[model samples]
Target: MPRRPFSPARNVKTREASQALPPLPLQDASAAIAQSKYFLPGEDLDGLRRRLARTLAAVEAQPQRWEEAFYHALHYAFPGGRIMANAGAESFKANVSTINCTVSRTLDDSMAGIMEAAREAALTLKAGCGIGYDFTTLRPQGAHVAGAGATTSGPLPFMDVFDAICRTVSSAGGRRGAQMGCLEISHPDIESFVTAKREAGRLRAFNLSVLVTDAFVQAVLDDTDWPLVFPAFRHEIGAVPTIWRRWPARDALHTVNERGETCCRVYRTLRARALWDLIMRSTYAYSDPGFILIDACNRMNPLWFSEDIRATNPCGEQPLPPHGACLLGSVNLAAFVRKPFTAQAHFDFEHYAKVVRVFARLLDNVCEISGLPLPEQRAEIARKRRHGMGYFGLGSSLTMLGHVYGDTPSLAFTTAVTQTLALENWRAALAIAREKGPAPALREDIELTPRHLAQNPALARDGHKAGERLPARLLHARYAPHLQAIATLDAALIDDLAQVGARYTHATSIAPTGTMAASVGNNASNGIEPSFAHSYVRNMIVPGEKAKRAVRMESYELLAYRALVDANVDAERLPRAFAAAGEIAPQAHIAVQAAAQAWIDSSISKTINVPSDIGFDAFKDLYLHAVAQGLKGCTTFRFNPEVHQGVLVREADLAATTYEFQLADGSRVQLPGDALVEYEGGRYSAANLYDALKEGFYGKL
Candidate 1:
């Protein structure tokens, strides 16, 4: 029999479903408030929501109207972490950017240029924004350095400076600065960069990724020799730090000289498959240096002509250009699912679409109101107006709807949801443009847009590029009827958009959410990710225990326990539909993320969890499969003895061993891990949020 397609009501008559979902218990609610710190015990949540709305809406011409709209949308509640933490809070509020991250262009290859870039990065980091940089601009090893009168040390050493700066400044400004570093696959020093994180405590503040190319993937598949090339002609015997090495890599027909150097200046060569294997092995074992499809990012970017997206913000979402900051928000999908787990289960479409459109306006207001750190970033904001509005609690939402995450029905449902939103997101941008004017960069000129450039292949190659006709993430999305009410308007707006453009450059993305939702928004699932476990231990740092004991944490799903009990369901049990991260297949995981990615204009931060016991060959196939699946980037995690921490822990694994630790009062207690460590009153990470929850020292339920 054919399964029923999801049909959300066009107009949600009541929030009876949301009211039915269990309210956060007192202890959990206390912990969540303690984590968010936006409201005090006696204060109503609406008070904080009102303050946030007033502050953000103040940017609009008519603040009061938008303020009410903002508060209404606040019911959906998935604003970015920075906004929740700082918005309208007198204690930490400022002209500071509420955006969580930015990627800075290291201006030049010289020491002065790098230092200048570092200074810029420091300023951005100090403003509570994480940063990213592509180290590809640095000269390869053995390059002459006239200033130092020595061969260049390569990009890795320079990255150490950024790393040190990050560590020093991470917690300096009441926020931890997250950093992401990227190097290209064809770079000569790529080997060193790949193995960088193998050392314990090395580059502790930075996440690394290799900017992979289509050529490299094809080369690996064909088992061809891939030459690592740099600008050989641009270098002199002792000249140091030259920005442009006026040399090009050899074409296929180019021949090698007698000395074995290609005329186009190949630095070194290796079998593509060998390099591919190393990356896979490192990812499988050490869990650093993920892959980013550089071409794919630029190819689909809304402002491709204006910038190059070489790196992403720390979380691998928001693939951005230099001087770009991440202004993000998410809609809580779990909140929208009605009659959860029953045959009558469905999403509240009217509410969802209304929330998306209203949130879109809210992000546009953020672009105006927040004081971004850099002049370049400010200019980017004024001209492009990028915002990463996305969704969280996808896994929980699917489970609530009785669909297993990574299953076909769930895939279709999410596709429909995202598709509906993608159109609405653009429509929102267009609606804003109608009043505020399209971003300065957006133009009707065929010469500038990717759509037009595609018509002329040669000019399209370098001059100007077009944005996606159909974003990769939504290539398969289909919306419900309420969205259809806007679909015609959406279509009209898009048709006008090709000529008039949008207020924002890029609109939709899937963020990591990073406990913003977990603690702040009633413990919603992480953005577009599944639950880590049915129940697991989370390390909660208590007072005066910066180095001692931990309070345990529990899953939000447990909130439904009381309701489950009333429904004659097992409160302690997880259903078959509750597909935790580690148990799901990697392919299934990627498939789910890819389905969401199709509609997203920016990127999605989702970790595909691979079982530690999986063989190397199967593990390696994961990355290849990600590429085939058309993912913008691929990040995978497996629990190895080397990196013992993980995001989700199986309940059985918690019972694997008894770990003993000293309490603050000098008393000792035995817990669930192989070893015990002091719990500081801050964020915990074995390396990832998923890992943190899965394998942290203690968990309270």
Candidate 2:
């Protein structure tokens, strides 16, 4: 019987209009498919099917008890979104969504509508979605409160209330709710804002960052004083009129330090170089306290003509104004990698670009399809229609290219790749603009320019030259205008090559790639991390197992595979291989991240792998050097065998060790041996085989 080709109800265009664009040379389809087996989910239908089958098996094994477990598993698998077979799981995923809220307006302006907003947040959190808020609007401490009693409680007090709501509502079992809180440099309470998370265990549910403006940065660079002011507001309390308190002169010094309590310490002598140093120090010490460039963010803002942006989402991916939600997605770059050494081993850039374009549209739709927690959030989304499009498997892609990360060559390669990606993204965005109309905020006056226009007559003619007299016709076309069309890009993109600078508010972000990478069957160091060693054991908790059990290399037999791939060793049989930071030079790892960072508009989240033997001085030097190289930030983890826990042993250390295992035929197997292997340093190994033998034949004895 002939099979009917599967077709989607809507034929979304996945390619550019021009067929003249070159196609990726086709390699052996079978070989590509074979290699793709490891790639997983890169191809379309079959990959989705495989995912469904695995999910079903996991669910059917525990029918009633597996709902929560399955939800998280599926969420991790499809971070963007997914269609599920089980209505229950689908509902669960749908409920566990993302929401953005505005908190930058004065309490009277913001809170008047906040109770209802908080209620929305509470409901969303209760249902399992993460929330993000821009806290730059609340008046600084000592500022008068208008509505209630005309008294002052400040942003912190309000945040405390929000914290309580988040904690209470996001406590659903197996559902972890998260929050992102941000403040601006100009805020009167910048000192408290900078160190809000300094106390350990505080803000357990939230991530924090400071929104720095170009003016603030320039002030730091110029060693000039910066001001912290608050807008005056009127409110009635107990039938008495009250006015918001104003600081006569709030200097940068006051914002950083107050009366020697470490309230804030502003260094007037702080040069841009010095401030940059401080930021790097803080980031390296505590991963909190990231920077958000305000001027750049606003200059390119499409809504520059309308609204102002203050903070970003939790992961620092989207720089949204108050109540703005960004629909996010990433294309798996490794999926586009072709195999073999000939010209045929080329990447399918055109197809990948097409997919990205569709993904962009899908993300936009997500904004419309998703339910908002506040009216402000819904209103903002409709006004801006923002989305975050990024990439995953960057490290894997670099490895496949045979480029050692952290090296000069790798850095150069990364720059080229980023440029290519930026250009493609621009083309896609432009096409979308033509189809759906440019975002309401997009400036009609912006123009495209070339990098070396000054030296090139042709470019000059196209309005790309610097200091060149423009002809009447070119002037009329309004070509070669400022790139600061999008608010977010104005702060991030340093070099302006394409006139498409502010094409979209924010075009890049790096997320924690752990779960998504895992579902794709890749070692999970998504955008900015090195593979954390090839074979580290994962500790798992099983019923009746007094202690957590460890599972080592369960799939692909990594150790064996590594040995097989080693050119120096025997090719016929696999050997035992353990990959450490040293296996692939540390420099190479750094280079790979640097490469990816080149293309990213925002910073990358990466931890450099250092060998234990490296001295503390060396570590400090490494970090300092990274900062000098213009890298946004760097974290390092040195391997210490002294801290290593030996292999697994016994479950008796934990007390009890008995459990039941389900069989394929709707049956159960009872196990009565140690289920956990205990080792020093709080590590454990699974004694499943031993337990299964005692339990009976149905177990994997």
Top of the candidates by lDDT: 1
Candidate RMSDs in order: 7.5, 14.8
Off by over 4 Å in 2: 1-117, 124-128, 142-153, 186-188, 219-284, 300-307, 340-351, 361-368, 430-508, 537-701
Candidate 2, number of clashes = 27
Shift of residue 560 alpha carbon in model 2, Å: 10
Q: For all candidates, what are the clash counts?
A: 23, 27
Residue 12, candidate 2: C-alpha displacement in angstroms: 41
Question: Tens-digit lDDT track for model 1 on 346-404?
Answer: 88888888889999999888777656778899887777788888888888788777787
In candidate 1, position 575 carries an lDDT of 58
- 310-404, model 2: which lDDT tens digit per residue? 65555555556555666555555655555411122335666565555444543444444445555666666665566556666554444433443
State the lDDT at 378 in candidate 2: 64
- In order of appearance, the predictions have TM-scores of 0.83, 0.58
> With candidate 1 superimposed using the best TM-score fit, by how many Å does residue 604's alpha carbon deviate from the native?
0.8
lDDT of each: 0.69, 0.44
